[model samples]
Target: MNLWSFLQDPASWVGPDGIGARIVEHLVYTGLSLLIATAVSVVLGVIVGHFRAGNLLVVGTSNAARAIPTLGLVVLVVTLLGTGITPVVLALTVLAIPPILNATSTGVREADPGAVHAARALGMTTWQVIWRVELPLATPLIVSGIRSATLQVVSTATVAALAASGGLGRLVVDGQRLGASGYPEMFAGAVLVAALAIVLDVALGSVVWGLRRRRSRIGRTAAELDSAPAAEATPA
Candidate 1:
């Protein structure tokens, strides 16, 4: 069966071993890893960026993480921990952290200095400034980083099947085991993963767009307010 035929067949999507089940498994892996990674990266990034410290730490760690081969890391982890969701999630969490950390660190560090100064002038506590001013302003970039991390995780999650874990990748791996007859399953699995990535990217892109629009509107409003008194005082 060709990829199209496989998709059209209802049987391919039903039952425990069907495409639907595999997709759910894939999402489970992705969600677990992303949840953990985002929490760790965002917190660390905020602290590092806000204090303007740990630049070397953030940069060095992110670079080192990026350099690690994810597949090899997964294999090694599985070897030590034994094959299961824990090992897969651990490897994936490592893979997902760097982009989010870097993006968040850069975003918070570069939050409008004027805004930070204004926040300080208002007698806002340091934490208040972070929660109210810096974080809101930095949201777009943070989300963008998450988007990048998500794509990486989705693509790499396929390797879970190698460790006897469940996911859409199982289709590809199982298809390979079946030799030439499994080409359709492999193609279908690849296509599904790509589709999932594109859909998620589009969704996250919309969030980024909305955030930018809100930021632009806020900027324009601030500019108008600042000019209003000057405009009134000027000679007509």
Candidate 2:
């Protein structure tokens, strides 16, 4: 069938329900997977990032997670959990955690020691030093990690369709079942996935940029405060 004919025949892309509904399903599955994965990884990463005791543990765990092959991990989860959204979510979360943990740990460990020391000198609590000094400096690296994790989750969520969770991957899988004539549908699914990745990456990147900008402003304000004359030294 021609591209025009395929477009006109809603069943090709949308299945029997229609294009809008299928698109919503694709987005819902993708969005939920990413959201859950991001939340879990970021929280775990941040907690692990804050202390020396947890550093080795976080690094070791993240490396192990990275070593697991995506398909193999998904298969294993499916075998244990049976086919459904939960197993797919668990698989994507596993794929996502490594980058987040690694980046967050690296960033926190490499945060500006001078600023951290100064915060400590001022009698700031440990949590204050972390929140005001370490986390700000580490924001960029954490953002990078999040960006990587988000992209990975988006790509892997498509595989969830294999377990009967509807997603854009249904188009590709169904097309493959129908043979070479279904190539266009497969290509279309690929295009949608690519577009989704790009959109999410750009959006997360903007958040990182904003964090960096805010950090810069905070640094400038701190510098100005440091240079200001002591209030008690002013002439009476």
Candidate 3:
């Protein structure tokens, strides 16, 4: 069960239970968890952040999510729901929502009040100020929260294998079942999960970079437009 031997085995990379299939399964499970978590957390976070209320709720929920062990939660949910992807997705979603919620809330609250006032003075409604003014300003921290949640979900998604949800973790679970004879498979599975997490984090970082760039461009555009009226009104 040497590492080299495992790499040389074409059967490991192809077919139903092979590496490729497992990767696809892993992505599906991970994607669904993120989508559901993001939808719920972002909406709630935006509302709370805009209102600047609910710090107790945010802090309490974040602490609670961190305290719950991912495997235990997944197992409990699977036990209640019967063996399926639904429970696993729920567990991973729980793991993801906290950071996103916290970050979005903080970002919104931290946005400059003067800018918010200006938007209001300009006849922007509360929703308009939030959407056009606050959200753009809060994009960086919101992305940061997403990146943190993404890393956590990518790592924890492996637990899905324990609930009969096929993923790259299948190799590790199978290897563990076979004991010493399956050491190489276990090692390969661990490596794959780590590599996958790294890849996902890097991808998220790029998204953050792009969002910041767009924000910067928007600021520059606004600055130029503001300066145009002043430059034209000059007495000289």
Candidate 4:
């Protein structure tokens, strides 16, 4: 089959079981996994990081997560749950959690101590200090974790197609089953996966850029205030 044949086929782009449906399926799996991972990991991470407690637990969890293979986890869950969205979402969420947890914990722990102390000195509550000073400053690395997790989830979600589920990966799996005759279809699927990954990554990066810019503004404002008293005292 010609590559153009599959690429040009209007049928592939429309209808209930077409590329559009598959893309939507992929997105749902990815979005759900990211949400679950972020909610669970970030909360725990922030608490641990803020209090500086359970360092060993955080490090061990991160390492353990890294050691577990995503594909194996997906397959294992599917075997027990027997197909459908549940197993897939669970597996993907597990896959997405580690990096996010690591980032959140590290980011908060590493935030400028002066700023954190200043917030505390101002009578800000623990929650206020975390929300205002820590989170804003730690945002860069947190976003980095989220972005990494997003890409991981998107990639892993492809395995859903293997379990008779819908995703862009179905194209590759189906095409491979067709052998050499399906190369064009397989190529098309692979291309779509790469393209989707790039688009998502760039989108997340843009958000990070905006956060960093805001953080910089806050930093500059604080610096100006610090210099104000010095400037007044230095006047001839």
Each candidate's TM vs. the true structure? 0.93, 0.82, 0.89, 0.91
Report each candidate's C-alpha RMSD, comma-separated, in the order given.
2.5, 3.2, 2.4, 2.3
Candidate order by lDDT, decreasing, is 1, 4, 3, 2
Candidate 2 Cα outliers beyond 4 Å, as residue runs? 2-19, 224-236
* Better structure of 1 and 3 per lDDT: 1
Tens digit of per-residue lDDT, candidate 2, span 156-219 = 7778768777677776787788799988777766777788889989998999999888777766
TM-score of 1: 0.93
Whole-model alpha-carbon lDDT for candidate 1: 0.90
Winner by lDDT: 1
Please write out the lDDT profile of model 1 over residues 1-236, one tens digit for every residue. 88899999999999988999999999999999999999999999999999989889888999899999988999999999999999999999999999999988898899877667666766789999899778887889989999999999999999999999989999999999899999999999999999999999999999999998876665555456556667889998
Which regions of candidate 4 are displaced past 4 Å? 222-236
Pairs of residues at least 3 apart in sequence or in different chains that clash in candidate 4 = none
Estimate candidate 1's RMSD in Å.
2.5
Output the TM-score of candidate 4. Answer: 0.91
Model 3 C-alpha RMSD vs. true structure (Å) is 2.4
Give the Å shift of residue 155 in candidate 3: 1.4
Number of colliding residue pairs in model 4? 0
Compared to the true structure, candidate 2 yields what TM-score? Answer: 0.82
Candidate 4: tens digits of C-alpha lDDT, residues 141-175: 89999999998888888888877788888888988
